[model samples]
Each structure stands twice: as C-alpha cells, then as structure tokens.
Target: MDTSASSSQVAAAAVAVAMALLVPILSAAAGGDGWEDAHATFYGDETGGETMQGACGYGDLFQQGYGLETTALSVALFNEGWSCGGCYELLCHDSTYCAPGGATVRVTATNLCPANYSKPNENWCNPPLRHFDLSKPMFLRLVTDFRAGIIPVTYRRVPCAKRGGIRFEMKGNQWWVGVLVFNVAGAGDVKAMAVKGSQDGQWADMSRNWGQIWNGDKRHVGQGLSFRVVASDGRALVLDDVVPPAWAFGQSFEASGQF
Candidate 1:
C-alpha cells in the first residue's frame, strides 16, 4: 500500500472537497428529483479490512467486485436489510473541511449502521436520522482531514451500474432451494424472486433466507429452471431457462437480464 500521499493527490482532493460544497446537486431515490440531507463519517483504514464482510451478506466485498465504493446505511435508510445492494450518490454539502470541484461518489449500500440503543442521543445511526459510514478512501476523496470525523452531506438514491448480468449462487439442495443473488444493475434491491421448475405448473415464491439469499420449498431436481426477479421498483424480469435441468447446488448461474 502507498503510505505517502503526493502533493498532486492532496491538491486534487482539496479541489474536489471544495467543489462538493459549492455544487447545488439535485438527485433522487428513484422517485424524488432532489437531493436529501444526510451526515457522513468514515471507517476502516487504507486496508479496508474492517469494511469487508458486512451485514448485507455480500461476503468478500472485493471478491464480489465492490471495492472501496461502498457504505453502510444508517437505520433510516437500511430498510431492514432490504436496501442491501442499493446505490446512492453523495457529496459533502457544506463544511469547513471541504476544499473546489464538486466531488460526488456513487457507492453501494453494503451494510447496516445499526442504531446504538445505549447511546441513542450521540449515535449518528440512530433512527429517524440519515447517515452514512463510508469507507476511508471514499471519505478522503471528499475531505482531506481525518480529524473531520463527521460532515454534512447531500445524498440521493441512484441506479447501480454493474458490468455483467445478474449472478445467482446456488445454495441448499432440491428440497430447500436457496440462491444468493448478486451483480444486479439498475434498482439493485430484490423485492422478491419467484422460481419455476420445468416440471412445475406454477411459479413458487421464494422468501428471504438471509440478506440477498432467497429460499423456497419443494424439489426441482432434473428440471430446467426459470427465475422471475422482481426488483425494488416492482418490475419483474423473467429469465427463461436460467438454469439447466442438470443444475446442482453450489454452482453459480449468470443470466443476461438487467433490472
């Protein structure tokens, strides 16, 4: 890891923070067109060790393709874990620490910043307040001072831009089929996933097992499988024959559908 910051790096960061403060950014949660108020702080060091495995079940963040571009959503925004993979755009609104050049960061909501019941009054993640626990790199990209532990910010939900198609990691067996869905673009959160076997007469709803994984009862062995993915926007995309009849547990399947 590079332990030293070059002069150019510092100057660039200062400019970005300054611009972030001056920009009048308007954004959305997919419905509204205006940026909302929020507070932000940073966690973990340059290694990002503490930021890796999180509450969202997005195990191995970098291995899953989300590098330092991630944040932990406070209680107000986590939506009880359903907002796990949602994306947001944020910038420092106004702060003494802010330095020119609007610097906005698009980050995936990878974890939950749980409310501290013991210190509700002091906890930024307490209910009714919108906050973000950003990774150190992302925070430094906006503010130069690590001492500026917290800063006022404006944020809005944005579509996640993923490179590949949706990937489903198969888990469990035929009797209790569980699949972990990831790499989703657009409205990244999955409201529900309906699975149908080639031999089945109708689609079977899969309940949230944990995080992004969904499970369903019944066996679909030796049957070509189809999936109906319903994203947070309430839109559904049916991937025909997403899995082969010989599909087995522990295998990942990728389908060319974006939502």
Candidate 2:
C-alpha cells in the first residue's frame, strides 16, 4: 500500500500549508515593529512657502485640502510612494541638535526626496537607508537650532488617529469610476482594495495610482459601493455599502471604522 511514502507526502503538504499561513502573520508582525535609526534634514523656507508638490500626487503642501499640512518623507522611506499617508512618530536623539525637551512629533508621509534618484556620486541623502527630508517648519520644530543641517533621529510607524472616520473621494463619471481613500487610522497606507457593486456579488480589484488613491474602471455609478481595504500591516476591513446609492462626483463618503 506504500503507506510510508503516502504519509510523507501528506506531511510535506501540511508543512507547506502551514508555512503559507505563517508568512502573512510574520509579515504583519514585522510591519508593526519595524523601527530604524535615521537621519533627518529640513528643506524649503521656514514658512513652508514655495514648497513643491510631492511624488504622492498631492498638490498642496500646507493648505485646506486633504494630505496638506503633512510632512514629507525621504524617497528612501517613500518606497515609491507606498508609504504615503503612513504616520510616523519621530524623536531627535542628538543632544546638541535636539530641543531641550526631546520633542517627539507625529508626521504623515507625503512626498519623496529627489536625492534618492540621484547617482551615488551626486546623492545628497546618501548612505543611510532610512532618512527623512522634513519640511522646514517640521524640522525646526524638532531641533534646538535651526542651523542644524542634519540630526540623528529615531522613527517608528504609528497608528494615524485622524479626527473623522475614513473618507472616500469619488471621481470620474458614469462610465468610469475612481475613488481616493483618505484619513485611514490604523495602518494608514493601503496595500490593496476591492470594490463590490450593490447589484453584483463579485469584488472588483482596485489599482493603486500613487499614494492613497485607488481606482477601478467599472461602470458602478448606479449601484452602491462597498469596499474591502487591506492595510500594509495585513489588517483588512470590509465596509459594507459605504458609498450610498445617491453618491455624486467629487463627494466624500466616510466610513465608521478603520483598519
């Protein structure tokens, strides 16, 4: 009956299934506790005027719009804007450079540093894999002296406690639909999203278009929108019928809970 070979095969299959389940759990744990020492530097003027738009597709820097007033991160930390909207708590460790109270500030990931794209010879934010190119205002807030060109800092990802609930911005028209998610709380950056139409039971995958914006080109205007969002830390939430049947273009919808 070849019982020994059959048992071995079954055992190997069990091990493979266990490993597959363990990978996601390990990844989530790593994402939650991943902290690193980094160097920080300031850019732009003290007033934050004349600041350029970031690679995350956010246009305004310090305005009333969403993602405004958020701090920009280095391109190294941006991870091609995948870290956009992710929140971090940073503290300056350099005694000489840090403020007297050792101030800690929470900042949202908004932009990417151009220096990361430069060649090794010309790279400004060089060597350090973890770096932060803070806005001039944010940088000054952490340092004792405004003249400190660089400061040693410790940073870790933290939950984003936005005032309101998670908001969804609607774009496109009756034929095509695009949705931009904002104000995510726990694990701010979305790893993936799926949308289900009220009439259809199937879930349609949404593609990422820089930062927190996700899009799906399905003619889903008439039906209500339900979203299943997966966070970077592997937390998933299904917000049933978040977008009501009477949704309009450019309108924002808020969900009660977050991932």
Pick the lDDT winner.
Answer: 1
Query: How far does residue 220 in candidate 2 sit from its true spot (Å)?
Result: 1.1
**Candidate 1: which stretches are off by over 4 Å?**
1-33, 173-176, 246-248
* Top TM-score model: 1
Writing each residue's lDDT as its tens digit, candidate 1 over 101-157 gives: 657899999988889989978999999999999999899877768789999888888
Weakest ten-residue segment in model 1 by summed lDDT: 23-32
lDDT score for residue 20 of model 1: 76
lDDT of 1: 0.83
Whole-model lDDT, candidate 2? 0.74
- lDDT score for residue 20 of model 2: 92
> Clashing residue pairs, candidate 1?
15-100, 18-99, 18-100, 19-100, 19-101, 19-102
User: Using alpha carbons, what is the TM-score of model 1?
Assistant: 0.82
Q: Estimate each model's TM-score.
A: 0.82, 0.74
